[model samples]
Target: MTKSLVGYGPIRQTRVGVSSSRGFDSESLGYHVGQTLGYGGERVYGRLDVDYDNKGGKFDSKGNRISPDVNQTDQQDTESLSVNGSLGVELTDSQRLDLAVTYYKDEQNTDYGPDYGDGLAVLFGAKPSLKAIDGANVENEPYTEKSSVNLSYSDDDFVGSGSSLNLTGYYRDEKGRFYPSGKTAGTQASEVWQANGLTDTATLKKLASAATFVTQSEADIEVMGLRAAMQTETEVAGKKTLLSYGADFERENSEQTYYGQDLNTFLASNGLTAQTNGLTYNGGPDTTIDKWGAFVNADMDITDKWHTSAGVRYQKLKSETDTFTPIYEQLLEEYFNSPAISGISAAYGIDYQAGDVEKGSTDHDKTLFNLGTSYQITPNDQVFANFSQGFTTADIQRALRDVRAGFVVNSDNVQPITTNNYEFGWQGKHGDTAARLSGFYNESDKVVRFTDDYTVEVVDTDERIYGVEGSLSHDISDKWQVGGSVAYTRGQYDKDGDWLELDAVRLTPLKGTAFAQYQFDEGSNIRLQALAIGGDDKAFKDQQKDPDASALPVTGYMTLDVLGQVKMPVGRVDYGVYNLLNKDYLTVYHQTTYGDLNRLPASGTTYGLSYTVDY
Candidate 1:
């Protein structure tokens, strides 16, 4: 069982103004403004169960069934609306100006019930059908809309001693649409039970009696963006200096059209319908992308306790495509006359065409760097260090088509997806007590993976993480005050490998938080809180049967919360409670094939209250 429904609405506005001129005599001006609006929605339903056990039959085949049970249902809907505005002006005492605008619209609807099949028909024991391998009934709808704008200007002299200057600009737009619902035989009997793994049920009733579900299609998308920036600050040698620079440009163009029936003329108008179950569509044309960038940064204070910063960045990218279709020139002559894909096309000896890989274009360039340092040691202590670099790009639907013309085998390299970061830190304060600590290291390259029906694969592998973040605060007298924070992480996947099944383990190793507050002299306050998160024990990928006891081990739990506040006269009043201990935890796991992974369950003990006013 599956179900979902959600909605949203928002609006905001702001304005501010001020002016002054001194000479033992002053002229003053002031203005301020604000506005806000909001809305909300949510609904969900769930259920699923799959059980199988056959030990000692040494793997039985033929519609393979030992203990089978399957059932399915799903639903989804989403909505959104937005608006924002801002303006600020002060042209005398030091010059200032600002303007902002934002608009957005969103709508979504999804309905897929019929127990959406295809995990090899729930692993070989088929039954429970919604019919569609051309027997018709499946649906889809997608939508999107967006808008943005911003502008700014600033200047301050204040006797030309601690100068300042600033400038900013921005723009954005987006539109999208998609609708699908024709081509059934239950979606080709769930893609021939996920590409040939259909353990016979009379070959799934002779491929669901020669299926043919075709009748829904439409798509459209658009995107645009722009940005500009500049900033400066001074007070040189005496200590305190800052400088920033920027330049940016972007362009994207896309067009797609693929309507009802044309997958090889509906598989030659339904004639040799099951040579491994038909209809595998592919498309890519009318596409364009462009990008440009520049950046620089600096922050200095050489001595008097030392401080430094540096940065650099540059980027350029281009892509293009359009042309080639006739069902991709007859699947590129049946993948160059098969032979198990022409021996991987003579062992990757290039030139494997579908129109010699038509409509071509490619270009890329990148550069990034940064450095930092800080030290004080006394006057409350301080220390810091940093280094960074990151980049990402590649994948325009397999870079403009041609994955060995559909039998797969093409390595026309185009790499990008890099990162290198390091950090060290310390901070302290006494007399009410305050503190901070940090440690980090990250190195990643390439890394991109998605299969199980969503192609795209790339792995260079390299990951190592080290963590230690801390926070502490105290003031246990005169109305009390206390705080706490803790973090610890250890992630690994540093070479020497073989672990793919959407690998990305370690998501949050150890986390902690604690809080307390009390005040009885002013209005009123009382609060208490606690939190903890953890992860460890993960590994899965065997493709069937004891690949050494099929891994699955996850166990860790903790939760608690409480709050209260009061200050009435028509203004402050709040209350809250959560978890408190009604535990039956499970925080997420879903890899479905009825390997049944859906458990983020834990919600009990809830309460809320609120009120505010001051005019």
Candidate 2:
């Protein structure tokens, strides 16, 4: 059977590779393997690929090893798998059908260490009895699957001999899941507020050993959509002209649930056993979103050296969320009425009530437009300018989910975001060298921002960003080449008619990369690259809500990498070394589960080697 397939003129191709390396901490071991297959013929073709990787161990800033926050028995780890495939068939010379599918999954065991807010006593220079909880951990797992199919038709001449037409239609479906589970130790509430300032060591130690906390959450999302487009081209006034139109329809659904519990509590030692089973639950019905949009555009070459184009789009969106009573309300009600809990409730001045939970829905319509022009500078150079308007509806999950008051708030009246963008660019090539430069300015309103505490809300002020980017590449010879790129950006947001610098994560002011490569005679080559990131001018302060949060300052770092490939008789070998200098740096800052600033550690020196066999 294999011999017969090869007799058909090499209709199939395949390649496979395997590699092993270490994670950033120079301790965790990581391994990966991948394979790709391709098939081609006169009328049909398809391709498929799969990849998997996994790693273990954890590291903190300052090059120290650390364990996960919740579990002393496990180490922080990550594993993932990806699969993709595409198939296409040509029914005729003027028609074709294509299909594609993708699947991906990632599982992470994260260590959160100790609770962030357990140091209030230490911060005040007072030695209290409650010991900090140790070994906190969370398991975060997310996965997605998507598939799409399309059919296309084209004709050299449709209604007139001088005009051409092309049409296409496509459908896609996507689904995903998010689940997080964690555990922690609880702090003593009474020791921190002792009236006598006793400094009693026995009391503090007993308080610390009284409780254990656990949490779990789950979210599922699905989106399906269909789209179609038609385009026509002809000669007008002895120049090229084109007209195009398209429409899209989509529906999305999201479901979310959350739970929290205190597994063990020794409040019974204080004659308060009524709250031993501290259970909490927050969830409701699913959120549904439906949206549709249509667009049309026209383009024409006004002259031999000039061209212009214009387009407009109209979109309509509607979202609805179901409501239901939270499970915690029922549990709280039972506790409130119990005589055994009366003394504990009075000691803490506890008062609780559930708010009205009702269904919510929103609908809106938006319009967007764009215009562009280009001028030929020479035979190999051109300059272009464009202006466009865009809009995006608020995320339905954020607008509808109210799992907890401070964790996930519900905002039914959230508005959409609108932005205007202007851009200019130039590109040219001369002999063995090529270059490009571009600049853009963008302004937006009703920007939705997610705070550190896992809450999402719309900002009232307007925001603007401007940036410039450039790239250059040159071929010194058939064996050697060099290239580099640079980018700079500035951002500001309006507050009471005042402009303040934007403090978001992706606002790096300056960044650049340069690389050089050398080619060998037997299809082997080596390349070296360097990357530079600039630090922020000022630190970002928390919104004054989290007293324990540290000020976040952007940190700049540089790294180098080397990659090479060598040819063999039946296969090829490839190798690469990353962060060659073992630079201890920070990649990004994130909000900890406790609403405090947490710095993400960058990988140190690591290397990988892989062998590939092709058929």
Across 8-115, the per-residue lDDT of candidate 1 in tens digits comes to: 222222222221111111111111222343222222111111111111100011111111111111111334455565545555556656566676654443222222
Estimate, for each residue in 384-484, the C-alpha lDDT of model 2 and write its tens digit: 99999987776656544433322222333555678999999999999999999999999998645545434455676798989999999999999999999
lDDT of each: 0.49, 0.59
Report the CA-based lDDT of candidate 1 relative to the real structure. 0.49
lDDT of 2: 0.59
Stretches off by above 4 angstroms in model 2 are: 1-27, 58-76, 108-213, 235-238, 265-285, 324-350, 399-412, 452-454, 539-551, 590-597
Quantify how close model 1 is to the true structure by its C-alpha RMSD in Å. 28.0
Following a full C-alpha superposition, what root-mean-square deviation does model 2 have from the true structure?
7.3
- Candidate 2 positional error at 14, Å: 5.3
Badly placed stretches (over 4 Å) of model 1 are: 1-301, 309-365, 373-378, 381-387, 392-415, 418-426, 429-434, 437-470, 473-584, 587-615
Number of the top TM-score candidate: 2
State the displacement of the C-alpha of residue 419, model 1, in Å, after optimal TM-score superposition: 7.4
